[model samples]
Every structure is written in C-alpha cells, then in structure tokens.
Target: MEVFALVGPLYRRVQRKIELDTARQGLSVGLRAVLDLLREHGPMTVPQMGRAQSISRQFVQRMVNDGAANGLVEAVPNPAHARSSLIRLTDAGRAAIEAAVAREHALLREAAGDLTTADVDTCVRVLGRMLRLFEDVDVNGQAVS
Candidate 1:
C-alpha cells in the first residue's frame, strides 16, 4: 500500500518535470513520450505504441498526427499489418528528442544535487522489483502464484 501510494506521486512529479522541460522545447509531454518510445523501441504502430505506453489508442494516434504535422514523425507501411502504419522518427524528430533529453539530464542532475549514483541505483532496483511484482498480479487483484 505504501509503495502503491508512492507510485502516483512519483509519477506525477516526473511527469511535471518532463512537461516543464518539453514545454521549453515546444513539445508536449505526450508527444515527447511518443518520440522517446519510438527512439527506444524502433518504429511501432499506434496500437503497439498505446500498449507500450499504457495509453489509449486514440490518444496515441492524436500524438502521432501532431508529430507528423510537426515533421517529427513519419508513417511507414507496416509489412505485417497492411492496414496499420508504423511511426518512425524523422531526423528532425531525433534531434528534438536529443535536445529534450539533454535538457532533462541537466534538470535531473540539478534535482539529484545530493543523491549519489548508488542511491539512485538502489531506488531503481527496488522500484523495478515492485514493478515485476505488479506485473505478475492479475486484474482481479490476485497474486499470481
């Protein structure tokens, strides 16, 4: 329960930071998330992106549309799914993400003022374990034993 409580606040704080940083770069948090997803996992369809980000397909599509309009992302034909298009980052998109990331890194460094590498590593390890535990649990709230 304590861990679950922390998740929401932590997520919101991280999102707020991202929002602030992305705003300076003229990108919304949603679009930045989509770009980061593509950069990390390669090109993916709207559905694939939605699943990966745990967001609605419609929302992901909207972001993709916005990105396309901004010349940040382009639609490529999906070989396996004829009707679905894969979204890939353009050179401009990659540059934007790179800039966003650099800004984020600076922000994180400032935020981490006193925290050491080991402290961050320990936090990551603990959070990763909690994530795995959550993943194994079912929707009905039963643990998968």
Candidate 2:
C-alpha cells in the first residue's frame, strides 16, 4: 500500500517524459494516441476510434484526415455505413510507428542503463498492472462506457 504511493507518481512521470519526447519528434500526443489505437484495433470508424481513446469524434476525424493526407492512414469503405469510412494505417504509417517505438526504446534504455534486464522487466510488469487498474477505474467512474 505504501509502495503504491511512490509508484503512481513515478509511473506518471515516466509517461510524461515519453510523451514529451514523442512531442519533440513532431508527433502530437493526440496523434500518437490515434496511431496507437489504429495499431491495436486494426481499422475502425472515426467515432469508434474516438470512443476508444476518449476523444471527440470531430477531433478524431480531423486527425484521421491529416494522417490520410500524410500517407499515414487510408480510408476504407465501411460496410455498415454508406457514408462512413474506416481508418487504417498504411505501410508508411506502420514504418513510422516502428521507428518511433525504436526511438522510445532507445531512450528508455539510455535512461535506465543502470537497471538490469530483470529490473526493467519487473518495472514493466508493475506498470502494466497499474495501467489495467487505471482502465478499470476509468470505466467504473463513467470515464468510458
């Protein structure tokens, strides 16, 4: 219980650092969030994607349009809706995401050079558990439905 008092803030700090670094690389946090959503869910409508990330549909649509223009995402015909299109990451988008992930991992490794692999693994596990807990809490709190 006492350990969580330290871990929570430290975990948030790490997240903030990663977000700052990603922002410096010309990827807005929202864009990264959109990319990550697409990567995990494969393809989805703007509304669906927005809901998944707790973003507004208008915002997601704008981001998807920008991504499509940049060749990072493409529009697919939606079977369920005649007018709505599904957003999917293009090959270029996947490559960019891979590059970003590699850069992030490199940064983490440099920052945690003193930590052994086992130590890093434990940190990851703890953080992952915390993330799951946060997600459940959010849902329970009506942050998502």
Model 2: how far is 83 from its true place, Å? 2.8
What is the Cα-based lDDT of residue 115 in candidate 2? 83
Candidate 2 to truth, TM:
0.70
Model 1 quality (TM-score): 0.85
Model 2, span 1-145: residue lDDT tens: 6768987797799778768976787676667777878888898999998778766899988888778877888999999997988888999887777777787788767777678889989878987887887784543366543
Write one digit per residue (lDDT tens) for candidate 1, span 1-145. Answer: 7977988898899899789878888899999999999999999999999878767899999999999999999999999999999999999999999889887788778778889999999989989998886886654566656
Alpha carbon lDDT at 47, candidate 1:
98
Model 2 pairs in collision: none
How accurate locally is residue 33 in candidate 1, as Cα lDDT from 0 to 100?
95
